[model samples]
Target: MTAVVRHVMVRGRVQGVGYRAWVDHEARAKNLEGWVRNLRDGSVEAVFAGAEDVVTAMITACRRGPSLARVDAVQEEAGNPDALNLRRAGERFSVLPTV
Candidate 1:
């Protein structure tokens, strides 16, 4: 499978609603490697790296985050794994400190 990486920003009532943790859980479950964190702008930022299809599914999932999360918009962009310091193999998904 060809691996792909993406950077996503989830907006709306994302913070203070367990969004990061939910993302961490989902990403791990999909065997994705990257990180999720909250932004001071009241949004959630995440990087997903894995099989192309799996990463796409993860982005779709971000649209309707955990029950409490009211995700308004999900913006996506091409991601550079190197920029995120992700290994091409065996990296773990994690919840990162807010940026």
Candidate 2:
């Protein structure tokens, strides 16, 4: 299966809403590779990589987000798999430090 990567931006009451933590949990559960962080614009951004289906599933999950998070919009863009190549080594998934 070909690998896929994406940059997802989740808007709306996303910040300080446990979205990042939920993302981390979900990413790990799905065995995805990437990171999630909070943005200054009160949005949650994440980079997920893995099999095409897995990445897309992560995107779908981002739609609902966490219980406390009210996701208004989720902007997903195709990302370069190489962008995460250096950072991920034998890692299934990880929650990046807030940026």
Give all candidates' CA lDDT scores.
0.88, 0.82
Which candidate number would show the highest lDDT if scored against the true structure? Answer: 1
In order of appearance, the predictions have TM-scores of: 0.91, 0.86
The number of clashing residue pairs in model 1 is: 0
Pairs of residues clashing in candidate 2: none
Residue 51 of model 1: what lDDT? 96
> Residue by residue across 1-99, what tens digits does model 2's lDDT show?
788899888999987778888988989888888877777878887889889998998899899988888889999999877657544567656555556
State the TM-score for model 2.
0.86
| Model 1, CA-based lDDT | 0.88
